[model samples]
Target: MGRHETISRRQLVQVQDRFIAAWGQMGAAWGVSRTMAEVYALLYITAQPLNTDDVMDRLRISRGNASMSLRALAEWGLVSRAHKRGDRKEYFIAEQDVWALSRKVMRERLRREVLPLLATLHELRDATDNRTEQPAGAPLRLASDDEPAPADARKPVTAAEVRQLNDRIDSLLELVQTVDRLGERFVGSDGKGLRLAANMLSKII
Candidate 1:
């Protein structure tokens, strides 16, 4: 019985190691650091909260790396800190609900990536409009009798080309705005909006 228990424990460790490695790779693919992903994976699989020292020892990482990773995870809402009575040390646990986890990740990405991109697109479109509104003629030159006058040499952008470019930019802007609106309607709030989104995704997937 002792040998069987030992073998089972070893197998469990190996399985957990595989999960940690795979989660790290997935995190890298999703633009998260490997260490942070591994730490989260470890916490996610565990039933109880773990302290910084436990994380460091289990992951074979330094104190600084473990601490920083934990902090980042906490900021992302993937992990939360726990306080045990009479224990001054902090322990961390992963958010276990799949829906909540997905919501947090999407919210962070939209804030960090999508909103900035939309702002940049707006700025670029405004600049393009301003450029297109400029007059197409060169300034009048004062001719001298001694020097032969030259023709206006500036080749300004044509109205048709500007209109075409503006249309394309407008189309792109509209597309982005549509996506932004959909995200807001679906994931921006809790309760009904989230349920609606989940239902829609269920049908589509």
Candidate 2:
């Protein structure tokens, strides 16, 4: 290669390395697997699909790690399989559209994290609803003189306290439901809703 072409290639390689590392860090923050994010970043920047060997070579990851990351990325809809004519090896490609990619990520987060949190909160709310019907022998019983309760005897939970806790849970549930609804609207269909919503918000802002 000519000097100019060689320099350009070297610069591109540097940028790719930087991006892969940065993306992996971001993925860790987002609770995604770092190797998976790096693998996706590599494929995202490359012009052609890469098989398992190519991915391992580029990222310096073991065969098992590369395979697992590729499988996970595929599960998240961030990567897809491709075949070259006359090639038996399975190659992978990343989702190139930024909007679609973001929507997919958000959808997974809503499904995996937000929904489960909401369910747990609902269970807590139910548990707190019937404070009065607490079993006969409550843990926080105040000791009488004859019974000689412990010096550190604590006051039992009251109906008012339960009501307050229930109300707080309700408030949190409302907020989380709003988020879930908004996430649903943003991620529905094939990426159009997200783009339109973002564009409209940008214009308003």
Candidate 3:
């Protein structure tokens, strides 16, 4: 092998293992399977496309596991299926466009986490609106004039305090809405808006 044929030597195994494990952990935190993330990391770092057998061999995963991971990655738009002219076996490659990859990930995360969070916040804000009605979507009201707390059991909340709490919740809702809109622009703009915003923010900062 030439001096620059590949990475350094046997010692590099440690680095590769560490990177794969770290990537898997990160993916797990983001609601992805650990092995699937490790597989994607491997395909990302590898310049050439690899087949199921190759992935299984490299990752020490079973064939079923490798196929399932690859299929999931393709579904997520993070990996692409490939083919060779003379070979019949299916191969896979990772999406090299990091910006697109990041956008997809953020889009999914926002749908999974942020959207639900906003719903919950909206419900909370409505609850703070002093509406004591017990609807299906609305949160349960704590105290109301009709059903006041027992004397000396708990300190009665003042109207001023309620207004202050509503204001605070409103502030939070506004901030979250702003973030949701920005995220929509970033993910929906196909990288143009993201780059523009990042460049402008960098210059301003």
Candidate 4:
């Protein structure tokens, strides 16, 4: 059967129910509220393209809630506006391709959440290091001949700590760079290429 004929009324209802529940679970994991997840699920499961009114009617949700949810979905790239033939009003449809949707959502999260945190961490590290001209630890400081330091005295480690911190930052930056590269490849590659990369990424991730 063709795509249109494959999805039946009973199947749509069942899929909608399952999608709604799954959305609740996934949303919680992603820091979204339960109701928002339900809204997303409603959009994801519908076989027919729907308008805001359709969404509100199917989900039995308020117009304001439907509007808010659709806005959020648009921002995430999971749903987009559909202009129907001879229709003045706009309809909406979920991205039918799951892989593309996944990529968009992941990229958004990495950009909005991970990259900012990484920037903040770098800023803090810089601020902490800028206060001192030389290494803080006695180990980093040149020993004075007249003031003979005791053999038992351990060297101070302020400089060493900073170096270690910088090293960690470098490692994290490398990982981020790799992620960006992989994201680019995924976006540009064909199905066979994406499948191979996905298999590799699963092992690494």
Candidate 5:
């Protein structure tokens, strides 16, 4: 067992304040609300689970705002609920391990954002392919074997444009799929692969 050093009240407050502010900024970049990120940051640094009133008071947020933020964090699996032995009020705690928290966030983002966008891209590609498969207007075969065809052949021109558009869409779809696979690998293997990569990079630098 290791001995624990006592942290002064002022030092603890300062640390918590810094974490909350920095996390609020990071939260926006991560596509989550600043308040939600602050709440998680506060919970993460606290040694004990915090009740709703405690969170609202410390964060200087309205009860509704704290409640909603906590709920969202819980939904994302970044925060969890706790119950004190004799207390009827609910308490919440944040997941403290940075790597695990990040993995959860990435997993949720892949499910909510990346996967849906990929599906939409697939639909667009399918629609474009269907349009390209059919003749643009009608067959443009010459009536006479020796007759010179019209300079403006609408059929070929339109078909070529449609095929070109479909090809572009196919390329975009492939890029998105590749990104999706990379995300899966990053957060997969229970985050072991990610940790290993981070360790290797640290040594290389």
Candidate 6:
């Protein structure tokens, strides 16, 4: 059979199903959980766009879970809702271009999750250091909580342990900086090597 005539709706479905599974496997390699990977894969397929109900039905996931996962996917910019003509409910579609998808995912992840965590780690490292070096009678406390112990009353974090944690945090901060730079480079142009480098770096994390 000719290529066009060989394709059937059933075959299309099977192809899409396989693609979804492959996308899920990629997600797993990036540290996304199995359920999250599956959710992402389903969104990555389906050319006509889909609503939450459709996703729930196709994936056999609960309504609430579908809603939550869709929200996350939207936040990641991997899936976005389609504004259809006269549509009353929300519908979603994936960004199909792989390079664009990777850039969007990297940007959002850096902004929403990685950046804040890096800031918090920096703050924690600073606080830990201040407690160690502060003169008697000062208090050390987390920003979110009251001072747990007075500087005079409590034992300070040891210099060795503090130095070790600081070193680890420094290394992590440097990695994030490198990722930021690479992300900038990728955003400028499609680079397969950048993605490969990112994948290798992620394994270290």
Task: Give the winner by lDDT.
Answer: 2
Winner by lDDT between candidate 4 and candidate 1: 1
State, as a TM-score between 0 and 1, how close model 2 is to the true structure.
0.81
Q: Which ten residues in a row have the lowest lDDT in candidate 1?
A: 136-145
Question: lDDT tens string, model 4, 87-121?
Answer: 87778888777777767766677778767766765
Q: CA lDDT of each candidate?
A: 0.84, 0.88, 0.85, 0.73, 0.86, 0.75
Candidate with best TM-score: 2
The list of candidate 1 runs beyond 4 A from truth reads 1-7, 130-154, 189-205
For residues 101-205, write the lDDT of model 2, one tens digit per residue.
999999999999999999988777766665677786755332335865677848888879878888999999999999999998888867477778878999999
- Ranking of candidates on TM-score, top first: 2, 5, 1, 3, 4, 6
Q: TM-score per candidate, in order?
A: 0.76, 0.81, 0.71, 0.66, 0.78, 0.63
Q: Provide the clash count, candidate 5.
A: 0
How does candidate 5 fare on TM-score?
A: 0.78
RMSD of each: 8.4, 6.5, 5.3, 8.8, 8.6, 6.2
Per-residue lDDT of 1-205 in model 1, one digit per residue for the tens? 3454445877887888899999999999997899999999999876579999999999999999999999999999999999999999999999987667777877787788789989877776665576555566733223345855466754788989888988988898899888777776556676456777678899999
Give Cα distance to truth, residue 185, candidate 2, Å.
0.9
Better of 4 and 6 by lDDT: 6
Relative to the unseen true structure, what is the C-alpha lDDT of residue 203 in candidate 5, on a scale of 0 to 100? 98
In candidate 2, position 112 carries an lDDT of: 99
Which segments of model 3 are wrong by more than 4 Å?
1-22, 25-33, 83-90, 130-156
Which should have the higher TM-score, number 1 or number 2?
2
Q: How many backbone clashes does candidate 3 have?
A: 0
In candidate 6, which residue pairs get closer than 3 Å at backbone N, Cα or C atoms, i.e. clash?
Answer: none
What pairs collide in candidate 5?
none
- lDDT: the better of candidates 1 and 5: 5
Candidate 4 backbone collisions, by pair: 137-156, 138-156, 139-156
